[model samples]
Target: MMPNRRRENAIIGLGVIALAQVRSRKRKNFWIKNCLLNHDEECPMPLLPELQENNPDDFRNYLHMTDACFHQLFALLSPYIKKRDTCMRTAIPAEQRLIATLRYLATGRSLQDLKSTTGISPQALGLIIPETCSAIIQVLQKDYIPFPSNPQQWQDVAAQFQHQWDFPNCGGAIAGKHIRIVPPPNSGSDYLNYKGFCSIVMLAVVSATYEFLFLDVGKNGCNSDGGAIMQTEFYKRLQNGSLNLPPAEENVEGLNFVFVADEAFALGENILKPFPMRNLTPEQRIYNYRLSRARRVVENAFGIFSSRFRLFLTPINLAVYKLNHVVLCCCILHNFLLRNSSSYLASVSTDEDPAVSGPAEEAASRPSVGVMTGLEPGHAELPSQDAHDIQQKYLEYFVGKGAVPWQEIVADYLI
Candidate 1:
């Protein structure tokens, strides 16, 4: 009798466990299939197939990439983002996962809003977007968004800057952009910035044609542009001579290719910032204008970046680390599209904003207005005499050899 009673109890416990799982599945299915997200006749969201067949333009608008570019990206990311089915639930299709993730990055819609359209729950998107963003950077970083590590590559970048922007031996222009985010839980004031909001910084070095040669993110917003850049590994590499920059110009023995920067950054042997705005001669004014012209590429890169990926305009509501991944992924995608998509630049002409935010939506952007020449440059550390000497050399170059037709006219207007 005892043996029989024990056998019955075991069977009863198994039955109870099975019942609980059944109820759990029911609840899960309800979240997946109920309302506008349902995969049924009454559903309103755009299906990938339907978009592919009917409205290719809408497909591009929705994903921020041409279908060809999408397929290329999807091909690379399939192995990373693909999911396997389980007994409890069928895995969301890999295509759908990519679609949902791209839409989030492209549109910067709230996860709740995305849920209604993608048939993905906000909970799922909160998980999927960052992971997909990581996959994007992992798959694309080496090729599309690489920083110049060798002297040859660095020289090539400098050559492009000289050829395109007429700034000789200029490897790149540096700019800092503030990206706002909801502060992490119990973080105290650690993430709070001078802007009276919590944010992170994206310090990038952009090529003359507006490609991102190097991007350093994850700095707290409290740090000034100089501080943020000083803390970067790039700065360490630059200071230590491990950056593998091309040989110095024939005219100057130790002067290498220079990066044009604004007042927010310090002048250095290889980094040129404009003369102080207070008092200036014609030579000084010309130098400022020339530096500003080269530096404007960084501003254009950031503006067009914000314009393309409206996500940069909206406050990203994710953890700091995940937000870093998102920023990295965007930089990668920006380069990828530049290389692959013919329509990418053409889309800039579109007046249509992909994501329209309510006024209540606190905007976080690169602040295109006052960036190229910041209004009031922060007083970081004073520069060494060597740095000043470099700036003087560039001033002479701008006035003598590198002078443009209208630079004198433009410089005089400023005075």
Candidate 2:
């Protein structure tokens, strides 16, 4: 009986090996190229030349960039993304690649859906869009979205803050925006935030004109606003004095110009957040008003980003690493459009509520770009005396010389 059983097992093993064997496969052919994609007739333009040349408003809406800006960007990006035509088919045009990528970011349409309109197969699109976005970032990043390192540059940023926001000696406004992503693979609760879904925080420092001065992303969603910023390289730079903050001129109340945030950030030598919401005197109320008002620039910048690049409004289907590339590309384009004088870009308004937090990051609403108001403090760490003095100096300035005419009225309204 044992001998018979061993023979049966040997036979079964031999059968299993036979079933697992794979023969040399036939050379595969294009499933959806010239036959399905009528590139010469239908999608050669991405949008037709007529639409771009004739209907300017609709073109900008469709692509989220003006035609001139689009042409300029293509000139820079085409070298990086340009491809050669194979014997089988002509290459997807460089202009189409740029247009398709911009539309993908602006509309958040799936590649399958994009296929019908762009006449590019979903397979080709999957390759084209990410690569083109990477090209956009690489070509434009150094010039369009550079971080300031010189003392004169920092002072210029501070001067902008003082001139526009009535916040003296303010270098910039800082905030954290949780960019929603599909749950990272094997990242058990790692990318999950207090709000219950997976995301990566975009910690941005914005100038007064709603441009990103510096931005760091990929903070685990589980961290709070303060926690996220604290974990960034910017925080390390701030600690080590490599951030190249200008020396306190006679203008800044004997302190370095500061970046303003809401309650979720720590007070530091060059960072300020609003006072506690509860039990605030009129002076403190004024301080909160001034801080929140100045911090709105960062929020508005995020709002404009989300508004123009509709991808942020949706849960991006790409992996974590790829999504970072896409986000940076969109951010660079944001700066590009603002700096590009070809056409006027209107920003979408924000509907921010510090009281409402959770899952709002993925809202599909276009006009009302959701933001974490940062009113809810997630940190209890004590600030140093230097930080406190910086806060006091700003408070005195806001009520004294730097006060906006309407601040008291707004502060009174808040009370």
Candidate 3:
């Protein structure tokens, strides 16, 4: 009877061992089928060749710039962002890293989508994108957006304005744009703009050539444009007369050389705005038209910039510090593309001849003016006597010898 019991227990133990083996085989086969390999060759991961093989238009559409521009940008950033391989993992090629970063900026795609398309893990991309942007700024900021350190440099900018917009003694066009962003936690409505979205103001001074000469970003969207500019270091320098700006005599007999801006900015000796159109002679109206013309350069700069880096088309979801780096990097990249004589710049002529129509009329007609749609008088002081005097001088210049041939016709047609 005891021998019979031991034999039965042995049989039960053997059956249990056989069942465990079968279950282990099933699990191993499931893992092999589902996770061991990619579904197909093409689905494995994206490669650089797949993007480059497409036509030029597709390349630009995908990367937001021409191959030449991408190559140039990659060259500038490669040294700083390159990585070395380790035993655990192979390093991503510099070209791949740059292309990935540009694709992210160009499309503003989700990291998951980017991971699938670029063959980068979302975890790695989370680290790579910001690092790439920081590397780009570190590499290009000095050469692309250098502050004018001499009177001659500022004069050259003024010369470009005179040749292009026919507004003399102008340094650069100044404006502010709201970069939409997702609000951080517990921050209240500090980032909420009048436009009913969270945003940060990107204040910039643009050259006639559509380059950003100076940029100050990350101001709260709720603040007025004038208030935002006051918070920048540039404002302090301007107030102290230490920004290497030309003397007041260089612009006109009595007026200081100035930047052209909208009415939201304060009227300062160094900044020129249009006369309020409330009650004006033909001369003041004409002066407003001319100033608006020069100011369009900065407006166009913002247009081209947002168009190129469509990331700005949607609200950025990064933290404030990261958004700052991204915005400044885009500004620098804009200048870089302009410097490189990109086809994008060539396609849109910045020097469009202002014929019979004044700049304000032309600006109103274009859809791009939506970028400057939110203009309002800021909490700035009233126009100073010197600023008014400068406006008067410019008004006289336009009505006098500086007038173009069609100015007389437009002047009569306007009022």
Clashing pairs in 2: none
Q: What digit string (tens of lDDT, one per residue) describes model 2 on residues 334-378?
A: 998888843434434333322242123213222233643232247
* Cα lDDT for residue 296, candidate 2: 78
lDDT by residue (tens digit), candidate 3, 175-281: 88888889999989998888788888888888878789889888888978788888888888888988788886666444568889888999888888877768777
Q: RMSD, each candidate, Å? A: 8.1, 6.1, 7.6
Please list all clashing residue pairs in model 1, or write none if there are none: none
* Cα lDDT for residue 69, candidate 2: 83
Local accuracy of candidate 1 as per-residue lDDT tens digits, 1-415 = 9999999999999999999998777444354455544433333344666886788898888887888998998999999999998986667667778888888888889999987777777888898888899899888899987688887888788777766656778889997888878888898887777767777888999987678989988987777888888899888888898988887744233355788888888888888998888878888988887787678778878777777788877788988888999999988998898899887766332211112431112112222383222222467787899888878878888888777666676566544
Residue 58, model 2: Cα distance from true site in angstroms: 2.0
Point to the candidate with the largest TM-score.
2
Query: How far in Å is the alpha carbon of 34 misplaced in model 3?
Result: 10
Native-to-model Cα distance after best TM-score fit, residue 60 in candidate 1, in Å? 1.7
| Candidate 2 lDDT | 0.76
